[model samples]
Target: MARAPRIEIARGTTFDQLMLWLDDMLAAFAHLPPDKHGTP
Candidate 1:
């Protein structure tokens, strides 16, 4: 499964700010599992 990146830009958002926000989101996303299927 592929998780789509979620980015929200506000009116006062700057390029650098947006980049940092994306970086944070990507980092957080990377920490999550791609799928959650398991068997007992």
Candidate 2:
């Protein structure tokens, strides 16, 4: 599988920050209906 780019926006950040960012991004994607990509 292809991988996304790894950007280091901040150095020495806490794990919580990273997890929050990932969760937010995932939620944003989830909001889009599956049909957007013709999945169904």
Candidate 3:
């Protein structure tokens, strides 16, 4: 997957930081198989 370039910002989370946070959040369910039933 292509990722956005990191940039230093003085506001809220940066793009990289947001991506990392998202990755961490999703990591909990990474082991689960794809939803073939599509019913989450």
Best by the lDDT measure: 2
Sort every candidate by TM-score, greatest first. Answer: 2, 1, 3
Summarize candidate 2's per-residue lDDT along 1-40 as a digit string, tens digits: 8987977757977899889889998888878899875655
- What is the C-alpha lDDT profile of model 1 across 10-38, one tens digit per residue? 57789999899889977887777667333
TM-score of 2: 0.55
TM-score of each: 0.51, 0.55, 0.42
Query: In terms of TM-score, which candidate is strongest?
Result: 2
Worst 10 residues of 2 by lDDT: 31-40
Candidate 3: tens digits of C-alpha lDDT, residues 1-40:
9987765445786789978977876785674666943445
TM-score, predicted candidate 1 vs. hidden true structure: 0.51
Give the runs in model 1 whose Cα sits over 4 Å from its true position: 1-8, 34-40
CA displacement after TM-score superposition, residue 27 of candidate 2 (Å): 0.1
Every candidate's CA RMSD: 8.3, 5.3, 8.2
User: Model 1, poorest ten-residue lDDT window?
Assistant: 31-40
